[model samples]
Target: MKVAALDIDGTLYPGALGLQLLQALTANGISDKSKSEDVFKVVEKYHFNEIDFQTMATSAYTLFAEAIAGISQAVMQCIARQVWQQERTKLFPFVPKLIDILNSQGYSLVLISGSPDEIVCCLAEEFGISKYQGSIFATHQGKYTGKVNLLSGSLGKKYSIFLQMIKDWRVNLEESLAIGDSITDTALLQ
Candidate 1:
C-alpha cells in the first residue's frame, strides 16, 4: 500500500506537539516539577531562538522522561486527548482537507513524530489514520518506567527507525508522499 508519511508538529499544526505535552503534564500536576523551572527556561530559550530545536527537544525529553515515570498509561492517554482538545483549534485549515484527500485515494496515512506516543494516537485518530510511530517512554504493566527512546535525533538514526517501522519501503518512493517541516523528518521524507 502507498504510504502518506506525515509529521505532526510544524507540518500538521504550527506548534510543537512534544512541547505542548510537557506543558500539559506540568499544568495538570501529572509531572514532577522539581526540574520544571529549569526545563521551561530551556523551552523559553528555544522560543527566543537562543537555542536550537535539538537542544529544546532534548531538554524537554529528558525532563518528561523523569516526570512521567510511574504515571499510568491510561492517565497519560486521557491527558493526551485533553491536550489535543485544547490545541485542536490551532490546527491548519488545509490539514483536514489534505488528510481526507489522502484517505480517499487509499494512501495509508502514517505519522512519524518526535512527540510522545499518547499525543500521536490522538493525532492519528483525528484523521482516522491507523499507522504511526513516535517517541516512546518505556512502560511496564501500564506504568511508565522512566526509560526513554526518542526519535528526534540524527537523520541516520531516524532513517533506520523509519525502515524498521515500514514493512515495505522500497516500492513506495514513486507514489508515496511525505510531509514534514524539520530536519528531524529527513528520514521519513526520504
Candidate 2:
C-alpha cells in the first residue's frame, strides 16, 4: 500500500487554520471588543520589555491557549464544524482534485495536522474520506495537565505509527509518500 501523508493547513487549505480560528473567535464574540488595540498594546509592551519576536509570539499563544483551556470538547467540535462548513469554499482549489486522484490510485490517505482530532475527523468525514490513520492530541475534562493525549498531531505522527500502519496494512515504505508544508512535519516524512 502506498501511504500519502498530507498537511491540512496551508497545504490542503489555502491558509492557516489558526487565522480561521481567530476569525471564528471574533465572529462568535469570544474575542475582546478591543482585541486589535489590545494586541497592539501587548506588542508595544513586549517591545519595551526587549522581548524577542519568538518570545512575544509564544506568550501570545500561551495566553490564547489558557483562555480556551476551559472550553469543552463538545464546544470545540461544534466550533470546528461551523468554521469548516461555513468556509469550505475558501479551501485550496486543487485539494479535491488531488484527493480524488490519490483515492483512485489506491493510495492510503493520511491527514496529519496540528488541529484537534475532532476537527480533522469531521473534515475527513465531510470529504468522504475514510477513518484517519493519524493520532489527535486533546485534553480530557477541564484540566490540561500540560500533557497531550495522542488522539492526532505531532506526538501521534511518528515513524512508529507509520511502521505499525505498514505492518497492519502490509504496505511498503519504499512505495509510501509523505507530504507536508511545515517544518514540524519533517520528522514524520524523514
Candidate 3:
C-alpha cells in the first residue's frame, strides 16, 4: 500500500504547534511565562536563519518536558483538545482538500510530528487520518514522567520510524510520498 508521511507543523498548518501548546500550558498554569518567552525568542531566531530546526526543537522540547512532567494523562489530553480547538482556524486552506484527495487516491495518511502524542493523535483523528507517529512521554501511574521519546527532527530517526511503519502497515517505500516543510523531515523526504 502507498503511504503519505505528512509533517503536521508548518505543513498542514501555518506555524508550530509548540506555541499553542505553550499557550495552553500557560493558561493552565503548567508552565512559566518566562519559558514561553524563551521559546518565542528561539522561533524568532529560527525565522531569520540564525538558528537551525534542531535548536528550535530542542528548546521546545525542554519547555514541554518541564511543563508536562507531573500532569495526569487525562488532564494533558484535555488540554491538548482545548489547544487544538483554539488553533483550528490556523490551518492552511488547502489542507482539507488535499487530505480528501489523498484519501480518495487510497493513500494511507500518517501524521508524523514532534508534537506531543496526545495533540498529534487528536489532530490525526480530526483530519480523518488513521496512522500517526509523535513524541511519546514516559508515564508513571497515569502521570507524565516528563521524559520524552521524540521520533521526529533527528537524523535517521524518521527513516527508522518509516521502516517500522512499513512492517506495521505493509506499505511500499517506493510508492510512498513524504511531505514536510522543515529540515527535520529531511531523512524521510530523502
**Candidate 2 lDDT, tens digit per residue, 1-190?**
7877777876787765644654576567654434423434554666698666445544444443444454565665678788878767887888888889888888888766655565667668877766454333346674333234552334334555556545667677678787777555677778
lDDT of 1 by residue, 18-91 (tens): 67877788888887777555667777887899988777777767776777888898998898899899898899
CA deviation > 4 Å runs, candidate 2: 30-64, 133-138, 142-147, 150-167
CA lDDT scores, all candidates in order: 0.78, 0.60, 0.79
**Candidate 3 local lDDT, 54-96, one digit each (tens):** 7776776766666677778898888888899888788899989
- Candidate that would win on TM-score: 3
* Residue pairs with backbone overlap in model 3: none
Residue 21 lDDT in model 3?
A: 77
lDDT of 2: 0.60
**With candidate 2 superimposed using the best TM-score fit, by how many Å does residue 66's alpha carbon deviate from the native?**
1.6
TM-score of 2: 0.70
Q: Per-candidate TM vs. native?
A: 0.86, 0.70, 0.88
**Best-to-worst lDDT order:** 3, 1, 2
- Give candidates' CA RMSD values in order: 2.3, 5.2, 2.0
Off by over 4 Å in 1: 47-53, 152-154, 168-170
- Candidate 1: count of backbone clashes, pairs at least 3 residues apart or interchain: 0
Candidate 3 residues lying further than 4 Å off, grouped into runs, are: 48-50
